[model samples]
Target: MACTQMNCSKNGTTSAADLTDDLIIEILSLLPVKSVCRFKCVSRLWYLLISQHRKRLPQTISGFFYPKHRYNNEDGLIGFPTFDGISGDQKQLFPDSSLPFLTGYRQILPKDCCNGLIFCLCWKDSPIDEADYVVCNPATEEWVVLPDAGHKSDALAYRLGFDGAMSPHFHVFQILEGDEDYGYISGVNIYSSETGVWSYKENGWGDNEIQIVDMRGVFFNGMMHLLTCEFKILAVDTEGKTWRTISLLETMCVGNICLGPLAFIGQSQGRLYFINMRDNDSSKLSVWILEDYNGNEWIFKYSISTSQLFGKLFGEKDHMLQRDYADLLLQRDYALVAIHPECNLIFFVWRCKDVLLSYDMDRGKVCVICSLKYHLYDTFPPYLPYVPSFLRIGKPRVEA
Candidate 1:
């Protein structure tokens, strides 16, 4: 946790003064990810220095500095011979492609990834403990399934996030029954990934009245943001072991806005965006970008309105516009790679691929390249979790 500096050898010849901060940054940027991580300890300046220079670095190196999320379009969502772009249909693309890496995965699906792992929570007709929690790496295609969440028929809610700065690198949040009283709501527990175990349980997280219909937890700026459709965003500091609440931007609450379906678009660079259901119209989409989320303060700086993606991008090859888009695949802001919407399937039908577009976020503009699908879907639990004597928080703590 210390940021003090140490003397540098400078190849055992050049004096430390001979190398300027910029010069050292250029050199470190060229080093392998491992070396740079170790060399950061040389000084806090080195840490900030490398962090600042991270973006300009080549993809090969920057991919390590900050693990890149697989842009759904770039990861070949439709994959292989088909290569259908983002806004394509599923049946049209499936003819040429094989089963998606995660074809059969449905309910409680993992629609996002971080570091190198993805989360999967399977919900059957009932909770029977066949296979419940699974953490996998699509890159390595490796998986780790946790023990039963210990939820009987009474698990009210559940969520997954990471706390690298904490003992256990990952944490699972769950709300379960409180007492024998009918639906009194008992405890909320967080399961740690590092320890592969869960904490006791707490209360008041979600058992009040507002049900978390659509939940997307985003870990950014060293914290986890839990997006719910109930009009409130629960932010938990994975590293700090605390929870706070954030609200949707007022700009997003206009028109046919509904409080039951919200989503965490993703964190790009260092900011987080939340996409919520605006109006029933398929053309009015609104999203908010927030930064400086240091657990205590969150600043909403960017608000984006849906502009027509018309022309060749939105229409067919012949420029015949078909579906009017009410959604976005933010490239400049493209961090949510696991989002698989029904509209994406439509993209397959259209045989789309590698289409270019411009990402305009009110003040800034960037060139972004991504594919399109004909479908759009949200990845949240469809039903409320059952309730039971789920272990309450403060139950007990085991050493990590």
Candidate 2:
């Protein structure tokens, strides 16, 4: 008689040979990026499925990458972990995790995240004349330091592009500011991981004075979007090598970014968003989405009332929602960071109060995510939406 069960209980459990391909893919898709990476070692079939699952399902924001604080003496890439609640509607923050990178000679500053890769700038200690521009996939712990592109500007910005399903490779775009015969010109430089080289596109910013007002760049519609100090939207097409400038709605508050980089632009569910917190009316905040990109139309989405969202913070003594509470949010010490792409969640950090808060747009609930004690300066910790993936750059490019 054959044995009913194998005697492998003492060693370990058996493999999931009974699971079908469709079922395996579905289960792996819901897991976190870190777990997916570890499961690759389970079996060859699981590894293949986890590697290609991004093409089967939609990708959402994983978490955020930032330093502890800008003014603080500590140095390195840091992680602000996010969690999923049992109720599905609730989310919470976990303990901070520091990213592994060299500490002494080089200081890493997290910049942009495209697809699932993060772009960081590594500054040298001694001379400090040139900085190392590096790109990394935090989930897989894969990083590469880019070669010198020969452009030296402190106000430069970066964007990464990759189509994991169509191609196993990715590229980086660097937007640079230069003075020309006419005026300031923003140039574009593209670095291909496959070729291991950088290509330049001169005069990328035609006639427009591209201001480096925002610290991060929004990647959407095959282009990189950034806000200028002049209140105009500056876009650079990575594929077409073109530039376009769209005017913001004409208002007294336009171009007045006195509250630092609080006024931000982000992309959610393929729709471009512009959060206008620069308004003097601090009680209500406005959100704009790019309804018609070709027509340069920005439609009003919604307005959130701070009086209702943060009323409890003021306490029962100040029961009558005072208008000054809104003013407090508008101060330069406050900022609006990441906006969830799939939902109405917004992340805000109040440096003066030393706290990070998340506001749910649908439920109208505000939750304190964490304390800013570790990240305390005016511009200490820079926040960027983090997405985890198993993509490996510099691999052979596949045909679409």
Candidate 3:
């Protein structure tokens, strides 16, 4: 951590300019993401250094964005306040005006966030003509409109991916569901910011055995993991240009455990994890890991008991728990919102709750990280783990 120009002579003849570029980059990378972003105005050298090291620096969960939880929709979209994950403090209140491009749009739906850029479905006043997919970099306040997929479908889901440290470009994957003669047809379309073009692969999913059930996708190790209604996992390989499905064990589909909403798939430590919140009992959740892809081997990892989670989170207030996570959620009125892919943590949002809670799987501890400022009544809002960056879309940078 030594300053490179510390030995320079006193007369102000030497400054940060006298320091080696490598040393400056090393020093700047040590600063917080927001601080580094502000220092981009210092000079072109600093801008390049900060932009290059943004991804290499420690990647922390910056905040969460929920588009659904707002006071009113008539007075424009109310910006949700984001809180810090580490400090459990309010970070910033994002107003609608800040995203000027979204002005006049009736519905602003967030699809995904990857390396700081957000992929959203912006539907204008008219449902047909103005509906389009937009990519926005909230940190830089820059956005780009993606080209159309050339066909219409009944259902749609999207996933975003980028490596800002290695490249300024990013990619978006669109999974479309439509009816066909057989039963259903699912297609995959890819949009690249670098090329400004949409590549379509019809019948992306050959078999109609199980269609993608939801929009939430886990992007890990160059693949996007999607869940199906039949307790199956669909992986869209962006690099390999292929789609494959992984079936859950028959034991997972029998009885109340077969319920799809009671389970979720998360990636941790470079592997896929299948978590099943017990339906009959709210006091436990089962965790499974995918050991082999081809052989379809899933090894049981461990079971997390809610007895401790409940005692720690809700205190000594005990009640009869039935119907598993939902009943526990009804008693405690806490909703299981999301799970982090890079770590052993699960996020929960309570009914009429403003705060976001994180439970560490390894430590068996739960703590408040931030506030949502919105209530979870019928459904959880469109939420995603966001990590801010200084990646510029139009600005020239090396492609990864």
Candidate 4:
């Protein structure tokens, strides 16, 4: 194949030696991930150059992978997974959203995603105790099924902890429910990829009586942060050695007349963020950030009103209309899907409207991303934020 104008040398020879290392990287960064992967075979230098600069390349959060409402025998999963591409042509990255690469398991449910890998619960049949925790990279189609931790049935939540920049190994923290108590947590079972083992530890949060309001936990800065029933963020390290508690906004702690505040905890731009709808006013939504991680201080960053979100304000005179809207909003059908890992944006889904939307925190603008496929049987499905990475699993780290 002939070289393009950008790659051709001055003398008309299509030689890579004609370009500087920086120039080659600049050109490679413009291509898709698959194309960049293929170029590694050209030479040893190209392989090293691409491998070292992989993080600096144009990798992005292609979309989200959520459970499809319907089931198919051919797919061999209880909830057939589907992807919704919100940016670029990256949807082509996953030709079969069903994830057929995972063999042997009749059912696979994605529980959480960190960096680029997905944490899933796999089962051969109906029993929950005979389950395996699998971590797989959708981009590379590489998966590793974890050994049974012996307390799969008692698990309340499974959170994946991984930072490719920090280390090649990953950890899975399984929050175990209390033996006698229903809402209380007993301890955590920690799994490490490096040792290929599962270690158990008693609750490290002291005597706080931890009760997670939501099963989903945010993995950031070597710690897994979970929102508690007390409206506070509880964080624990992957080693299960250190534990810390960060309080939510004072106003958010107050109880509500309706179905409690629609709150979610997430990480973006290397900082922890908490977003929620105001309890007193259903129309108002606020975003808080931990400006200083060590200080545990939360600074109110931005707020959006229903008028700004929906594009029209409701007047008090329309009492019936306002009441209906409030009821719909507080019915626990809406969810803050994800906080953009790289930007001042949030993606959420409104089940009542069957629409997925993005709110820009910087510009205070709301944009409809796409219309969701409404399923009557499905409640609020978890939308895991996914940024595809071509990193291979169970491989030695190639240091840049």
Tell me the spans in candidate 2 whose CA falls farther than 4 Å from its real position.
1-59, 69-96, 101-106, 124-131, 152-155, 161-167, 180-183, 252-259, 278-280, 320-322, 395-400
| Leading candidate by lDDT | 4
By summed lDDT, the worst window of 10 consecutive residues in model 2 runs over 81-90
Taking every candidate in turn, the Cα RMSD to the unseen true structure, in Å, is 12.0, 8.9, 7.7, 7.9
lDDT of the candidates, in the order given: 0.42, 0.63, 0.63, 0.74
Tens digits of per-residue lDDT for model 3 on 1-400?
3445365546645578777877777786666555666788988877887777665554456667666545564644443323334352426434442355555566666767776788877777665347777888876778787776675775466778775655677878777666654324467777777777767776655575556554467766566777776677777766437677788863232122212244667666557888766545555777788887567799987777766665565554443332234344533445455676467788766544556778888888888776555433355555566766765777322347
Position 320, candidate 3: lDDT: 37
C-alpha lDDT (0 to 100) for residue 363 of candidate 1: 36
TM-score of 3: 0.72
For model 1, residues 241-290, the per-residue Cα lDDT tens digits are 56567766543331122222333455544456555435353343455556
TM-score of each: 0.50, 0.72, 0.72, 0.78
Deviation (Å) of 375 in candidate 4: 4.1
Q: How many backbone clashes does candidate 4 have?
A: 0
Which run of 10 residues does model 1 get worst, by summed lDDT?
342-351
Q: Model 1: how far is 106 from its true place, Å?
A: 14
